[model samples]
Target: MDETRQRIQLVRLLYVSRAVGPQTTAVTDSILSVAQSANRQRGITGVLCQGQGLYLQVLEGERGVINALYNRITQDRRHQDVQLLLLEEISQRRYADWAMAHVLLADDDPMVQLHHPEFDPYSAPGASVLKMVADLVAKGERIRKTSV
Candidate 1:
């Protein structure tokens, strides 16, 4: 098959980074605003979890687009020590509903304690981090529904 006719593979990428400054509402809001606009245009979906000066994000999209986004994120001045935790080809997106979903975690969030006691993304295994993100997303959805 020709290159154009070949199927493009989808992928899910997870990464962790530390905020260069405080993890304030304005900072995260700006990041989300930009990301949502860009990601929607690029056909990407993902969830961003921020807390305690750390950012744990999972991006899902075509391989090249996802890779390019990751590259840009690593160079973004707002984030430091960006570490890619997982990158794998996938048949479907886990976060298809949101172009960029934001979950602001608190140090004492019960879900965090239930999923991972220490809740340190830097030291946690890739699979564990992914699981935590999934749980958080589910929890967010539940909260949104109840509040609606």
Candidate 2:
């Protein structure tokens, strides 16, 4: 396929990162505001799960767009140690309706205890993290929807 075709290929990318400063509501809201606006225009959809100063996010969109977004995220001062957990072509988006959905997990959240005693995205497998995000999304009240 041509470069253009390759760039437009639909894919899902999951990543984990640590917050540089305090994980405040204002900080998360600011990130969502920018993400929702830009993602809507770029045709990106995803979910962001944050807690304990860590961010676990799944982004789905054109391969090139998502790649570029990830690169930018790695450089953002607000985040550190950004690690790509999963990246693969997908038949369809799991969070198609959301430009960016937010999930705030407390240290005591049950989802964290499902697979492990403590929530540690870096130590967890990519698939497990993805499943956790999926489960969180399934619980409507747990996710703050920001649809495109």
Candidate 3:
């Protein structure tokens, strides 16, 4: 059997949390732990978005492995009204080894702000960000630029 090169399993999840007011530290802790655990269980590694009660994530790895975890993420109890925004295979893996990495946009993480639409990570939207994100990920650089 030929060794298969890793394929990035990318997915976007738009989820609304049940919590009211601001998200708590305890909640963030649990969520982070879950991300790491998922990495161990499924060999997935990528970025996550958690803000304003929404959780968006990108997972990459062997196709079978990532798809399995993607299925599980959709059914996870932590999120309600889960809608899969996007799911597609990309040519390469984004992270070197994350198991899963996350950036909390809601809590004002500089990095998240930079990447978020409002922050304008690429100075403007469109194809530039797409290429820039790919480059950053390929270089194992976390997309967390400060915006101020």
**Candidate with maximal lDDT:** 2
lDDT of 2: 0.89
What does candidate 3's lDDT look like per residue over 102-141, in tens digits? 5554445444455554633224333443443344444443
Give the per-residue lDDT digits (tens) of candidate 1, residues 123-145: 88999889988888887742211
Using lDDT as the measure, what is the rank order of every candidate, best first?
A: 2, 1, 3
Mark the regions of model 3 whose C-alpha exceeds 4 Å error after superposition: 1-22, 107-148
Error of 1 at 107 (Å): 1.0
Cα-based lDDT at residue 113, candidate 3: 53
Clashing pairs in 3: 111-144
Order of models, best TM-score first: 2, 1, 3
As for model 3, its CA RMSD to the true structure in angstroms is: 7.2
RMSD of each: 3.3, 2.1, 7.2
TM-score of each: 0.90, 0.92, 0.57
Angstrom error at residue 48, model 2: 0.5
| Tens-digit lDDT track of model 2 for 1-148 | 7786565589999999999999999999999999999999999999999888899999999988999999999999999999999999998889899999999877777767664576678887899889888987786656799778
Pairwise TM-score winner, candidates 1 and 2: 2
Report how far off residue 13 is in candidate 3 (Å).
8.4
Off by over 4 Å in 2: 1-7
Measured on C-alpha atoms, candidate 1 has an lDDT of: 0.84
Q: How many residue pairs clash (N, CA or C atoms closer than 3 angstroms) in each of the candidate models, in the order given?
A: 0, 0, 1
Model 3 clash number: 1
Error of 2 at 45 (Å): 0.2
